[model samples]
Target: MADAPTDITLHQKSKILEVVFEDGATYNLPLEYLRVYSPSAEVRGHGGPMQLVTGKKDVGVEQIDPVGNYAIQLHFDDGHNTGIFSWDTLRELGENYEANWADYLKRLEDAGATREKLWH
Candidate 1:
């Protein structure tokens, strides 16, 4: 069976998604992190290299809708609501948060990018 979260809370002020798994593990995922690493084809790419999503340091999740019993669809404040985050995916993100975050930062640096939202 896939790992399931026991509870999920969205702390809007802090822009953090708190996920508590059935196994007693809890992950506090920042909205920016979630947005940049969204599993949607737009970010993950369609059978190609994953896209480097920048300028989302201030992104926030506006809502979360369940997808049956296995996953959830996250509605981001920036109007991105396509990524369906599965239980396994969330678990993996929680488990590898540090490494993943570090890798993301390195990738951004290598590309001469910044997380700061660019003004129009």
Candidate 2:
């Protein structure tokens, strides 16, 4: 696993989360993507079925709280604050962004939903 984030900046205007890892890899992750891909059990179920979060076109992160040296909890504008995103998870999300995004889009299509990505 790569090192944890050395820095994290929230761009409220652009609704982006900029994370710089200790391994020198940085990622500009969308707020919506983070919301949808939250590691919370509410979003990701205990076992089989997972939830399909939707209608988060303009969701923004309200706050970010650090967890015990392993992860960070994101407080989203929609009142979601359970996801504990670890360094490894964040890095994987950055590395596999393209595929994950594509899969998200495909899931939306499969569910007859809209992309609903906020454009600024």
lDDT of 1: 0.93
**Per-model TM-score on C-alpha atoms:** 0.97, 0.91
lDDT of 2 by residue, 1-120 (tens): 557789999999999999998778999999999998998999888886777888787899989999988888999998999899998889988899999889888888899887574446
Q: Which ten residues in a row have the lowest lDDT in candidate 2?
A: 111-120
Q: Write the residue-wise lDDT of candidate 1 on 1-120 in tens digits.
A: 567799999999999999999879999999999999999999999999989999999998878999999999999989999999999989888899999999999999999999999899
Q: Against the true structure, candidate 2 has what lDDT?
A: 0.88
- Top model by lDDT, which number? 1
The superposed Cα distance between candidate 1 and the true structure at residue 60, in angstroms, equals 0.8
**Superposed model 1: Cα runs more than 4 Å off:** none
